[model samples]
Target: MNFKSLKTLAVNGKQVIVRVDFNVPIKDGRVIDPSRIQAALPTINFLCEQKCRIILLTHLGKPKATHDPACSLQPVFEYLAAILPGVKFAPIVPGTAEAITRSQEVRPGDILLFDNLRFHTGESENDLDFAKNLAALGEIYINEAFSVCHRKAASVSTLPTLLPSAAGFQLQKEVEFLQKIMEKPQRPFIGIIGGAKISTKLPVIRALLEKVDYLLLGGALANTILKAQGIAVGKSLIEESMVSEVKDLNLVTNKLRVPIDVVMAPSVEPDALSQTVAVANVPDEQRILDIGPETLELYKMILQTAKTVVWNGPMGYFELPQFEQGTKQLAEIIAGLNAETVAGGGETLEAINQLKLNDKFTFLSTGGGAMLAFLEGKPLPGLEPLTIE
Candidate 1:
C-alpha cells in the first residue's frame, strides 16, 4: 500500500486538483454536518502553504449522472468560504470550457471549488475522456477522499492515472491507522460489528474473526446469527438468505459473542411499549430493537479488558431514543477505557458525533465502506494509480 506522499511532492505555484469528500448531510440549503469538510482542511491548508492553486473536486449526494440542483455542492462551498480564506467557487458543469476557464483563473494559494463532479455523466462511468478533461485543469492530482476511495469512478480511479498523483494527508493517515489495526494490533484486540445488513458486513466479520481476539455482534446482524443457531428472534429483522452462510461460520465458538438479551417491542415507534427479555423468551410478535442492560454489562466487561478496540456500526437503531441506550452506553464505556480505540462507518460516526465523544477515541475514520474493504483485505481502486510501483 505504498503511495506517493503529497508532502514530498513538488507543487509550488502549480494548479493541483484535490479530490475531497464533501459528501456531507445538507438540510434546507445548508450543510448540516461539516466533519467531512473539516477533515480535509489539513491537506487543503498544506497545499495553500506550498503556494499551490488548488482546484477542489467533490460529489455531494447521488446525482445519478444528471444535473440535479438538490445534489449540488453549493452549500459545502458556502460553508468552506466562511471558514477558509481566498476560496472561490466554480458553479459550471465539470470538464467544460467554463470549468477550464474558472480553474485557470485560480491564483496561487487560493482554492477554486468546482460544482458537483457527479453532475457529469462520465464521472461515475470511469470514462477516460472525462478524466483526461479533468486532468487538463491541473498538473497534479491528490486524493483526499478516503471515504470514496473504494469506488472505481472517473474522478477517483481514472483521473489519478492521467496526472502525477499522490495520496493526501487524510488518505495517508487513514491507510496507516487501518493497516496498523490489521497487521500489528496490540494484544487483546476486540472488534465490535453491528448494523442492519449481514450481506454488507459478512466479509469483514469473517476477516476480523481471523485477527481479533474477541468479536462482539449487535444490531440486526446479530439477529441472523442467533436465528441460524435455532434461537427464536421473534419478529426481528434477519437476513434469511444469509442464514446458511452464518451457519457455515461455526457460530458455536468462544471468540464470537452474540447478544444474550435484547430490547424488544411490537413496533419501532418511539412510544411503543418496549421490554428487555432474554434471547430465548422473545414473544412471537415482538421485534428486537436494541441490546438489553445485561448484554451491555457483558460487553462492557469485555471492552474493559481490551488493549485495542475496532468498532463499526451501532449496537442498535440509535436513531430512536429508546433504542439508543445500548450504543450510547457502549460508546461511554469505550471512551473511558485505556485502549487504542478506532471506530468508523456512517451510522457509527453519527452515533459518536451525537454522543459528543469524538475526542475520546484514538481515531475516527472518515471512511465507511473503504474502511471495511481495507480490513477485509481487498485492494482499493482509487488507491491503485497512486501506488508507488
Candidate 2:
C-alpha cells in the first residue's frame, strides 16, 4: 500500500504505462456509461500536464485468442479520443512482437492505447514473456484500475515485476477513501449489506458485525433469516445452514434489523401475482421478493442517524419495476443523507442511477469483487506489487 503515486513519479520525460479500467457497458457500438473512463481522467489529465508519454492499457470485453469483433477496443479508442482530443491513439495489437516495436516510437506528451489485452492468451495467463514485453514499453507503471485490482493478470500483477510501478490518483483515492471506514469511523457508523445469497455475503456480514453500530439486511437473504427464526417465509429462497449463524450473530434483535413485512410474489417476473404480507405470517404459497414499506422506514431512520454509511448490493430485486420501490426508497434515503456515504456493487449503482441519486453519495466505487475482497482484509495483487520509491 506504500506505492508511489503520480505525485512522486517524474513524468516530464518518461514513457508512462497506465493500467485503467475502461471496461464500460457497450450497446450498438456506443459506450453507455462513461463513468469508468471519467474516473481515470484525473490521472490522465495530470500525466498530460507533466508532459508524460502516456500508454493506456485496458480490456474491453471477454475476447478469445481468435479476436471477437464484438469485444474489440476500437470503439473505446474512438470514445476516448473524443473525450481527450489532444491524446492521440497508438494501437498495439496484443500478442504481437510489433506491439513492443510500435511502443518504441511513442514520444513524450503523446498518448497511445493498446488493443484489448484479453485477445492475447498470455495476458490472462500471466505469461512472463508477455509481462516483460509489456514492461519494455514504459519506464514506469501506474495502476488506476481499481475495478480489476483483485485479478492477478500479466499486465496488472506481473508487469510491475519488470518495471517500477506506482498507484495512480484514482487507485490512491479509492484506497484512502476506503481506509477511513477500516479505521474506527465516526459514531453511529451504520452499514447496509444486501444481495441474493447468504452464502455469498457471509464474509462481509461477519466482518461488519464487529464494526457497525447497526446492520440492516434485506433482499433474498432476509427471507432466509426470517425462515431461521421459525417464521413462515413461504416460497422464498432460504439457506437452511445459515439459520445457526443468524441465531449465533443475534440478528433477530434490533442491532441487526430484518424486514417485519415483505412484498411477495409467485415469481420474480413483472407479470407475477404479488402481495405484501407480515414477515411472521407469510402465506405458504407466496414467494417474498422485496422488503415491505415498514422495513424501508426502519432502514431510513438508521440512514438518517448514521455519520458514516457504507452500502453494497440491492435491498430487493431492483431490476423488476414491481419490486423496485424498496430499493428506490433506500436510494432516496441515501441521497438525502449528509453523512459520508460510500456505495459499491453493480446492483447498488443501478438503483442509485434509477433513483437519480448518483451524485448524492460521497463516492461510488467502480470495483465489485475488488471492493469486497479489500473490505475482507485480503490483498489485491494488482495493487500489492506497486512500490512507493
Candidate 3:
C-alpha cells in the first residue's frame, strides 16, 4: 500500500497518533543512548510543523501488569526534551481515559508521550477492545518504529487498523534501503554473516547464498563451521549439534568461506596466553574466540574487489581485548571498502563504534531482529497494518 505522508494525514487539526521505537537502553534511571530518539526527529518535526496535535505511543523494557516506575516513559520524555527542546512533553498511561484526556490538550507543535504500552497486557495480546480504545486518540496513525516492525502489538499493528495509517520517515528509509539489497545489489556482492549462534543466522545465510557472489562466515557461527571441517577448536565454545549439520551443508554450497586460521586463548580472559593456529589444529583447552591473521587477510582481499557488501554480526567475542581483532579488522575492511556497504546486528553495531568507523559505512541499521527478519522474507507486523493508508 502507498502510505500517505504525515502531511496528508493531519487534517482539521486532527490528533495524530505516532508509533515509535523508543526502546533504548537506560542506566541508573537515565537514558544512556539517544540515537533512537535522534532518528525520530524528522518525523516529529514534520507533524508539528503541519500544526497537528501529536500523541506518541511506545513501549520500553518488559513490565508486568499495572505501572512499573522502572519501565515508565519518563526517561524518554527527558530525552525528547533535550533533542526537541521546544516541543512540550507529557506522559499518558495506556487503557485509561486520562491518557486520551491528556492527549486532547496537546495543541499544534506540541508533543505528548504515552506511558509504557506494555503496562497493559492487551497491548501484546492484540485485544480488539484495547485497540479500539487506542484508536480513539487520533484520526491518523503513523508508524515510525522500524525496530519493532516484526511485532504485532497495539501500538504497532492493531492501532493502524483503527485509523488512517502511514509510514514515518525512518520506516520508509528502512524499506527502501533494504529493498535495494534484495532486488539488485551491485555485482560481485560480498555477504559477511556472523553472530553468536548458527540457529539465529541460518535464514540469512540461506538467503545470501542465492544472491551473494561470496559468503564469509565468522563469530560463534564460524566455530561450528571450523569443527565441521575437522578442526580442533580447543576450549572454544563450539555447538556440538551444529557441526554435523554444517558438514552436510558444505556438500550443497561450495561457495561458503569458513575461517582458515583463528586467534585462540586458554580462556576468554585477557591475560590468558594467546596464540594462532591453522584451522586444522587447535588446542583442546583453548577456545577460539576470534578469527586469526590469515583469515583477516583473506577477507580483506575479497572486500577490495567487491562491488557490494552486506554484513551482520561480529567476527569474534569482541568484548574482550584478546578476541577483538577479528571484528575490529572486519570493521576496518568495511570502512575502507570502495563498495556499497550495509551492516546490521547489535554486536556488529557496537564493534563499528569501537573501531571508530560508524560514519564510514554506507548505512548502519538501527534494527537487528527486524533486519534479519526482513532478509528472511517474513512480513513485518508493525509495517503491514500501517500500510492500509
Leading candidate by TM-score: 1
Report the candidate with higher lDDT, 2 versus 3: 2
Ranking by lDDT: 1, 2, 3
- Runs off by more than 4 Å, candidate 1: none
Q: What is the TM-score of each candidate against the true structure?
A: 0.96, 0.90, 0.89
How do the residues 1-389 of candidate 2 rate in per-residue lDDT, one tens digit apiece? 46677787666778899999888888899887777899899999988888888889899878755577888777788898787856665555654689888888887767888888887888889999888888888898889998898898998899877787788888888888887786868878988878888877778787887788998888888777777778888888888888777665675467788887888888888698778878887888888888999989878877889888888878788778889888888888888988989988777877786667888999998887788777877788887787543
In model 1, residue pairs whose N, Cα or C atoms come closer than 3 Å (at least 3 residues apart or on different chains), thus clashing, are none
Candidate 1 vs candidate 3: the lDDT winner is: 1
Best-to-worst TM-score order: 1, 2, 3
Weakest 10 consecutive residues of candidate 2 by summed lDDT? 86-95
Q: Per-residue lDDT of 1-389 in model 3, one digit per residue for the tens?
A: 34456556545467788888888888787887666777788988887677777888888989865788889888788878876745555555765788777766777767778888898888989888898888888778888888888887777788887788888888888777888877889988989988788877777788888888889998888887767777677777777877776776562454778888988777777687778888777877778878999999988988898888988888888888888889988899889988889888767877786667878988877788889888878888877765544
lDDT of each: 0.90, 0.82, 0.80
Whole-structure CA lDDT of model 3: 0.80
> 1 or 3: which has the higher TM-score?
1
Error (Å) of candidate 2 at residue 262 is 2.1
Collision count for each candidate, in order: 0, 1, 5
